[model samples]
Every structure is written in structure tokens, then in C-alpha cells.
Target: MDMKKRIYLELRNRTPSDVKELVLDNCRSNEGKLEGLTEEFKDLEFLSTINVGLTSVVNLPKLSKLKKLELSDNRISGGLEAFAEKCPNLTHLNLSGNKIKDLSTIEPLKKLETLKSLDLFNCEVTNLNDYRDNVFKLLPQLTYLDGYDKNDKEAPDSDAEAYEKGLDDDEDEDEVEEHDEETVPGDEDEEEGEEDEDEEGEEEEDDVSGEEEELNDDEDDVEEQQGLKRKREFDEEGEGDEDD
Candidate 1:
């Protein structure tokens, strides 16, 4: 039997019921693909935290007073919604270094309004667009995400936008501060690039405005043709009435 199974058997056989925290880091729950975790730790009523990092225990037993949970570096793909329903008082969650690719899987955690911090570092969902934005919007009560504070709104939009676009991650943030300490050449070239970008943006806007005007003119012409047709129909009806 693997270490995880041995440890689980130990929990079932020897562990007491009043155990508050069950931390089986590194998926040490057991081997041989144990099924139905709700039965394994069924007696741990006062269990507050379950730090089973690197374990493959996807389904957990119902713990009423559980608050903090750590399940990093495991094969936990989904089923966070059902898990959140059973553990409503959950505050701190660490699912970093897992196989979590879908950001939607954690949407269920929004129901736990008491949740203050969430850790999804080194996960595949970090590659999603506006990962931090969507997570914050989903869980407004969250004060921290991936170790960053939620109230840190000091970053300018240009920096945030570049970070979202993946252009800022590989670049060193200290580059500008280092450059500021000395008289750097080619500063004007950067300004010229910005000017060129602004000009291109203006041209694109002009093109869009021209397209909209042409569409409006086409609509006006169609309305004029319809008005003329209606007038002609009314005249024909009047003539028919006079002939009668």
C-alpha cells in the first residue's frame, strides 16, 4: 500500500474524532485510488483546516467547522462548486501548483463571502485573460489573490494593460528605475514610437467613423424610397375613391 492509503487507514483506525486540522501534505492521503472521501474523515467534526497538498483526494468529507484548506500540487481538476457548498465557512484556500486550468471551476467559491484570500499560483488558469480581474469581480470580498493584495489598485492602466497582454511579465520592472539613474540615449526614439502609435490610433478611428456615416446614408435612402412608395399608394387609393 502507498503512503497515502496507509495514512488514510491510520486516520480511519487510530485517529480520534475531535481532530481539528488534517494536514496531509504532498497527496499523502493514500494510494490505490481510494473512493468516497466523505467516509474516511467522517468523524472529524471540529476539523477546521485540511492541508493535503500533493495528495489526490478530490472528494472530501463534510466538515462543518472547516475554515482553511490547502490542496496545492495535486490532480484536482474541478468540482470546487460542490466542495464549497459543503464548506461554507471556508476563508483561506490554497490551490496553487495544481492542474486547475479552468477559471470557472473556482466561481463556486464566490458563495463563500467570508473568503479573504485565494492562492492559484503556478496554475494553468493564470494564463487566462484578466485572471485577476475576473477573480476579483467574482469574489469581491477577496482581500488577497495569488499572494497579492486586492486593494492594491495603484498600478496604472498602461502597466496593467501591458501585463494583461503578457508583454510585462518577461520584462524587468527595475529597468526604468535603473535607466533613470543615468542619462540614457534613444529616449526620443521611445517618444517617437508613442507618437506613431497615437497617429495610427487616430487613423483607425477616422476609418470607423467614415464607415458609420456611409451606413447612415444608406439607411436614409431606404427610408426616402419607402416614404415615396407610401405616398404613391395613398394617391392611387384617393383616385379609386373619386372614380367610384
Candidate 2:
């Protein structure tokens, strides 16, 4: 038998306690060939670069002891649901350059609370914010992501800048509302001032009308008194001429 088949058959007969790490990367075995081996070595602590064999590896039971899994540069697809269901103790997972397109594929990985690093660089991922938030929500212990430190100074500064921009937008909206309110009051005050001036002018005209009416009444009374005095004077002059 060839070397690859020899290693494969040898691993099949062995139990889980016999191996702590296994690397079958770049091997000549096809898809289903590694499934039997994974069942035989389900408790492996490290597995790496088993090209085109990740989806089959998910069938392995009791893989809770696995710590590091590297499936980079492979043809792995259908998200990380199978891997998360199979390996709950994974700490380092490198799925970079894979065909993972959605965040749901990696949601099952939240059960691996011990995961500290994850790599999804150059994948079909288009939304980083949703991925970062969902990953952070799931894996709080993750400190390194896509090759960058989580506590990097620039990251927090960029977050603060985004927050400040949001606050500035809110403040601008409030200012616009206040300006609108102020203009409404100004318009109301101008309208009220004009109304008050109109009322004052009406009162002044009414007062002028009352003064003219009183003057006309006084002139009529004076003319009636003058006419009465002239008639009495004429009567007194006729009586004096008759007496003489």
C-alpha cells in the first residue's frame, strides 16, 4: 500500500486516546475517506489543513477536546454550524479565504466560548459591522479577530468618532427644531404687535369721534341760548318805545 493509505488504515484501528494531534493536509484521500478516521480520533486536540475534508470532519463525535482547527484555503462551505456542533472547545479557528458569505454560518460558534481568535479575511463577507457585532455578542472572549487585536487603540478611537458623529447629527436636528420654534414665536409676536397697533388706532379714532360729537352738542346749545336772548332784547326795546 502507499504511504497515505498506510497512514489511513493505521489511524482507523487506533482509539481516540492514542492521538492528541492529527494533520492530513494535502493528502490524496477523497471526501468520505477521512470520515472514518475522524470517528476514530474524535478527541484530537489539534487538526489542521485537511483540504476538502472539513464538512466530513463535522460528523466526528466527542470532539470537545479539540483546541485549534485550521481549515483555511479549503473548499469548506455551509457556514460553521456543523463545526460548532461538533467542536465546542475550539479556541483558534482559521476559515480565511473560504466560501463563508453570511454571519449565520458562524453563529453556532458562539457555543465555543473559549475561542480567542477567528479569521474570515478575504471571504465573501461584505458587511463587517454586522459580523463584528454578532461575533462579539457570541464570543466575548475573542480578543483577536481577522489578524487585529480587539483592544487596539485605533479601534476604540474610530468607534468614538462614529459616536460623536451620531451625536452631532442629533444636535443639529435639535437645533433645527429649536430654530423652527423660535421663528414661530417671532412671527406670532410680530402678528400680535400689529394687532395691538390696530386696536390702539381704532380706540384713537373712537375718542376723536366722541370729542367731535361733544363739540357739536355744545355749539347747538350756545346757538339756542343766543337766539333766546336776541328775542327777549327785541321785546324789551319795543316796550320801552311804547312807554316813552
Candidate 3:
């Protein structure tokens, strides 16, 4: 059996259920294509790294867990955009010795904000005069390229890195800021409490005023009864005087 079939059979027999890294060099992936051969290694569920050289694959299996992918010496001319979207969390990539001829083909890799390192040592795109400038400009999140500036000393004012340095979130001060957590949450609760208290106070005041009005009405009724009794007594006295 050949090396490709041998490796496939061996790994299948071993039953690599938790395997993460896979290295298949010279597996004739470019010649045989990536769909059918990748189906052979269906046991790789938690695969994170794929070092498959010379694979002219049009589409990769929806490997959401893959972090690093190395596809050197291949002919994936216009698939980096879909590749980046497929593996949205890739941090390391190596596409050296490929037939990528321009920056537009690989510009899709710029959206990979988590990508820290990239390798394009022998690709045809590296021959351009604006190669380094374009790469750094396109992928400002990159920390290392080829071998130069591996530490990313040039990106001191990177807004992406500012979050890591506690620039985006710096609210821990002795003085309170306008956007404080205590201000928003606590203010809502306090406002609601004040509204409830005001409503209760208004209800209590209305009850007291209603009682005062009832007392006034009772006093007026008593005064009207007294006036009627006085009139009746005055009429009875006049009638007695007339009889005498």
C-alpha cells in the first residue's frame, strides 16, 4: 500500500477520536482533490491543525475548530476568502510556494482579526514591490510575517491591541465616570422607588383632604339644624302673644 492509504488505514484503525493535529505531506491531495480523500479521515473530530502540502482544494470541510492550516505548494488561486469565513478563528496560516499571484487573491485573509502569524516565503505574490506594505496594511492584526518583525514592534498604536492593554476598558478609577455601572443600574431602581414613594404620598394627602372635607360638611349640617330650631321657637312665641 502507498503512504497515503497506509496512513489513512492506520489512523482509522487507531480510532483517533480526540486527535487535534494532522500532518499529511505529499498526500497527492492536489492531484486527487480534497473532498473524497478528506472523507477518508472522518474520525478527526477535534482536528485543529492541518499541514497538507500541495492540496488544490476548492472547499475545506466546515472545520470550525481548526486554528492552524498549512497548504504549501498548491493552486488555491481564489479561495482564501471562503477559507477565512469557513474557519473564522484561525490564528496561524502558511500558504507558501503557491500560485497566488496578487494581493487581491489573499486580501480576504485580512478579516481574520485573530490571525497573529503568516508565512509566504516562496509564493509568487511576494515578488511585488508593495508586498510587505500591502500585507501589513491589509492585515494590521498580524504580529509576524515571514521572518522579519516577528515581534510586531511597528504596531504600537494598534486599536486591536489596545483592548489587550486595557485601553478600551479603563473605568477602574477613584472618581466616578458618566458611564459607570452603578449609575445606570442603580439609577433605574432609585427612580422607580422615588416614583412609587411619590404616588403613595399623593394618595395619603388625598385621604387626609377627604377627611377634612367630610368634617366641614358635618359642621355645616349641624349649624343648619340649629338655625331651623331657632326659627320654630320664634314663630311659636309670636303665636302665643297673638292669642293673649
Candidate 4:
């Protein structure tokens, strides 16, 4: 769809003045020129027109409140000076996948004093020798280029990044809790198994004691019978002597 119609659809029953952000990505522009956007969107803070076939921002409406702009995947090679006057407060500008071939094409961005992050990924200029160093020197106000700083550290979290990180943290905590829960049951089962083994060992000991008592009783009965037999034999011999 055309940029104008797309913007209207994205409004979603809100007036332009009430809108804080707008996205018109992949919309057809009129021969690389923006259309259907007006200055009434003064309250807009973020605007994205990615892959809209824009070769220049000369027709861009004045947006003093704009902070971030996404214009990646266009044919824009130069004329970046328009941003200095149009979006004076812009801090992050993404012009990746464009036709920017050299430093001179982007030299106009130096006027953006508040600019902090600039992305030129997939552009011809990135292949130049000492690209990052040159860009940093050209725009001293820039703290990051292509997502990294002069020291190669990543930029701090944005609102979206922080939200995603929080979700990951929550998932990790849940996994730990599940692991602890599972371990408790396993420990209880181990303790129960040990108790069962102890009970079996006690039963075996009692059975051995009962068998030993029965064996002792049988031995006492055999001795008593042998003593009675000896006493009877002595009496018979005495009677025979008396008869003789």
C-alpha cells in the first residue's frame, strides 16, 4: 500500500497528535519520495519507514520531537543533511542496506549533535578501511555504530531488550524450582527404601533366635532320657546279687 494509506490504517482510531510512534514499513513511496505524511504528527517520537524505496528525505516533515528513525533498506545514497533540520532531536538513525558508498555521502550527519547511535550495516561504506574509526572521528557525538561502541562493547538494553531478558530470567528461576521439587520426592523414596531394608534385617534376626531356642530344648530332652536309662540298669544288677 501507499505510505499515506498505510499511515491512516496504523492510526487505529487515534489522532495524529496523540500518536507517539508510527511504522510505515514496506509501503510504496512516490518515486523515492515520501507521501501522505504531514507535520500534524508533531508528537511522534519514533518513526519507521523501512524499505519504502526512499532515496532522500528532502520531503520529510519537520519533527523536532523525533528521537529514533528507521530508514533501512532504501536507495538513499546522500543528502543526509535533511535530518539535521527535520529531526533535530534524533538520537538513533538506522540507514543500513542503503547505497551509501563513502564517507562524503554521510558527512552531512555530523550536524546531528544529539545523535548517539548510527547503523550503516550492509552499505558500501562499511567495507572501507578503518570504517568504524573514520565514522567515529567524523561524528564524535556517536557512541555506537552497527550495535557496538568504540570499545566493541554492545549498547545498553533498550526497553524491548530488557523485557526479553526479564522473561529469560523468569524461565531460569522456574526451571530451578522444578528441579528442587523433583529432588525432594527422590530423596524421600530413597529414605523409605532404607527403612524397608532395616525391617527385613530385623525379621531375619528374630527367625534365627527362634530356631536356636528349639535346638536347645531338643538337647535337654536327649540328656534326660540317657540319665533314666543308667539309673534303671544299676537297680537290676543290685537285685541279681541279692538273689545269688
Candidate 5:
């Protein structure tokens, strides 16, 4: 028997209340065998790197006392819901280089308020949006993730760049709208100015027409008076000649 089996058998024979920490690092055990070990060591507070020999589905039994878990470099696939449901007190989890595809595998882990560090490097995970706030929302004690320190200044620069790009796009849109407004003519103001010019033009035309009409009427009156005088003189001369 290997050293892992011997240690597992020893722990199994001992009372559960006596065990606190279990370190089976670099051990060679398949997924099914690992599950059995976890069940046998349920009272253990620390479990480290026992999945090194796993080549199939990884099953971690309900270990309520487990505080730290390290399962790095395991070929385990599918169903992390078991981990979240089983290990409620887990604080540190290392599942780097696994084939975990969806966020659902990690969803059950959200309840672990004590989880401080989570390693998920080189996984098949594509969407980090859903777990962005929900996973860490309750875990104020958490500080590190995926081997990157949260306080590292170099990490957030990409997020900052995205935010700046969004703001710049908004500013450009606003500037375009303002420029359009300035160039466009106000219909109400243009119509009012045109109406005032039309009224002034009509008044000037009416004044000119009235002056021409008055001048024509004055000339007609003067000509009529001159004709009456000429008629009177001709009649008087005719009477004189007849009388002689």
C-alpha cells in the first residue's frame, strides 16, 4: 500500500475528534479514492493537494471543518457544486489548470464567506461578469485571486482603460450634438426676422404709390382749370365780334 492509503487508513481508525490538519500533498490517488479519503477525514481543518493522482471526476465529501483546500493540477471535471455544498468553512482553494467550464461550479462557493484566496488560472472559464461582485460581495476578508494580489496597481489598469474609453465616447457624442445644434438655424427666429422685413417693404411700397397718385391728381386738376379759363376767353371774344 502507498503512503496515502496508509495515512488514510490510520486516520480512519483514529477518532474523528482527534484530527485537525491533513496534508496529503503529491499523493497518487484516483478521483474515487480521493473522495473516500475526504469522507474519512471530515473533521480535518486543512487538506492539501491530494488530487495529484486524479484522472476522473473529483468528488470531495462534506468536510464541515475544512478551512483550507488545495486541489491544484487535478484532471477533475464537472460539478464544483459539491465543493461549495460540502466545504462551508473553506478559506483557500486552489483549482488551477482544471477543466471547469462554467461559473456554476464556483457559484456554490459564494456562501463561503471566509474564502480569502481562490486560484483558477488556465481554466476554461470565459465569463467573469456574473461573479465579479457576487462572489466577493460578502467576502470582505478576501484579498487575492488567481495568484494576483488585489492591491497590485498593474492589474486594474485594463479596467481603468475601459472606463476611460467609455467616458471619451460619451464626450465625443455630446460634442457632436452641440455642434449640430449650433449650425442648425432656429426656425422661429428666422421666420420672425423675415416677417419684419416684409412689413417694412410693404410700407415703403405703399408710401411711394401714394406719392405718385397725389402728383398725378394735382396735375389733372391744374390742367382742368386752365382749359376752363381758355374756354371763357374764347366765348367773350366771339360776343364782342358779333356786337360790332
Candidate 6:
């Protein structure tokens, strides 16, 4: 469908001021131009019009709240000054797969004070020597060009990273909970069984030790009594001989 009808359908009965994001990718445009979009979309923060055959952005209405713009896969060559005037708060812009040739074509983007990322993959300008370094130097405000910094580090996908980390954290918690649930009671039961066995063994050893001690004491008492009787009998016989 044409860009106008596609945008209207995307609204789905919501007014333009209430819309925060709009996706118009792969839609037909009027001779490579934006149409039906107006300044009434004051609350729009993101707008994607990729592959819409747009050659310029001269018709973009003032979107002071816009932060990200996707105009990739279009015929846009230059006239990026329109972005600075219309989407003054833009931070991310994708112009990949366009007819952009050299540094001069994108030099106008320097006016975008808040622009941090620019994607120009498949554009002629990427073939230039030191293209990345030169672009970074030209647009000092930009932190990334085609998803990499001047240090050649890839951009961090915050949302995806957060989601994966969240899943990992949840998995770790589940593992801990499962281990506690399955192992704790079994460990307690094993410990209790070991204690019971030890107590029983100790009781049997005490009983045997007590019985042996009592038998030894009885034997010693009997020997002492027999010695006393013999001594007394001997003394009595000597006294009778003396008397005779």
C-alpha cells in the first residue's frame, strides 16, 4: 500500500498525537517522497520508512520528540539537513543501502547534536579509505557508525542482553530451589539414621563393659574373704599348743 494509507492503517483508530512509534517499511511512496505525515504527530518517537523509495527528506514535518529514524534501503543521497530541523532530538538514524557516496554527503549530519548512531552499510561511502575514522572525526557527536564505535567494538543490544541475563538469573534461582527441595530432607534423614545407629552401638558397648566390671569385682571380694579365714584358723591352733 502507499505510505499514506499504510500510516493510516497503522494508527488503528488511535490519533496521531497518541502514537509513539510507526513502522512503514516496504511501502510505496509518491515518487520517492514521504506523504500524509504531518506535524500533528507530535508524540512520535520512532518512525521506520525503510525501502519506501524516498530520495529526500524535505517533506518531513516537525517531530521534536523523535529519537530514532529508520530510512534505510531507500534512494536517499543527501539533504540530511532536514533531519536536524524536523527531528531535532533524533539520536539513531539508519541510512544503509542508500546512494550515499562520500563523506560530504553525510557531513550535514554533524548538526544533529544528539545523534549517536548512524548506519550506512551498502552505501558507496563505505568504500572510502578510513571511512569509519573519517566519519567519527567529522561527526564527533556520533558514538557508532554501522553498529561499531571508533574502537571497532560492536554496540551492546541492551534489551536482548537484559532478557538473556534475566533468564539466566531465573534458571540459577530455580536450580538452587530444586537442589534445596530434593536434597535437604534426604540429608536430614540420613543424618538421623546415622545418629540412631551410633547411639545403639554405644549402648551395647556400655552394657558389655558394665557386666565385665561387675564380674571382676565379685572375684576379688571372694579371694579376700578366703585369705582372712585361713589366717584366723592358723592363729587359733598355735594358741592351743602353747596352752598344752
Candidates' lDDT values, in order?
A: 0.68, 0.71, 0.67, 0.94, 0.69, 0.94
Which segments of model 3 are wrong by more than 4 Å? 1-7, 10-12, 30-32, 36-55, 150-244
lDDT by residue for model 4 (3-55), tens: 88999999999889999999999999998998877899999999999999998
lDDT score, candidate 2, position 166: 100
Q: Give candidate 1 regions above 4 Å deviation.
A: 1-15, 27-58, 153-244
- Can you give the TM-score per candidate against the true fold? 0.49, 0.51, 0.51, 0.68, 0.48, 0.70
Clash pairs, candidate 5, are none
Residue-by-residue lDDT tens digits, candidate 2, 1-244 = 3325645665677665687877766554455334444455656898765454444445445677888887776666664666667787888888887778877777777777788788887778635666666666666788777766655422234558999999999999999999998788579889999999999999999999999999999999999999999999999999999999
Q: How close is candidate 5 to the true structure, as a TM-score?
A: 0.48
Considering lDDT, where higher is better, how would the candidates rank from best to worst?
6, 4, 2, 5, 1, 3
Strongest candidate by TM-score: 6
Tens digit of per-residue lDDT, candidate 1, span 61-174? 566566777766665667777556666777778888777887677888888878887889888998999889888998899988987776664423454787676756545556
* Tens-digit lDDT track of model 6 for 161-198: 99999999999999999999988867988999999999
What's each prediction's clash count? 8, 0, 0, 0, 0, 0
* Residue 215 lDDT, candidate 2, scale 0-100: 100
Each model's Cα RMSD: 29.2, 18.9, 14.2, 5.4, 18.3, 5.3
Clashing pairs in 4: none
- The 10-residue segment of model 3 with minimum total lDDT is 45-54
**Candidate 6 residue pairs that clash:** none
Candidate 2 TM-score, C-alpha based: 0.51
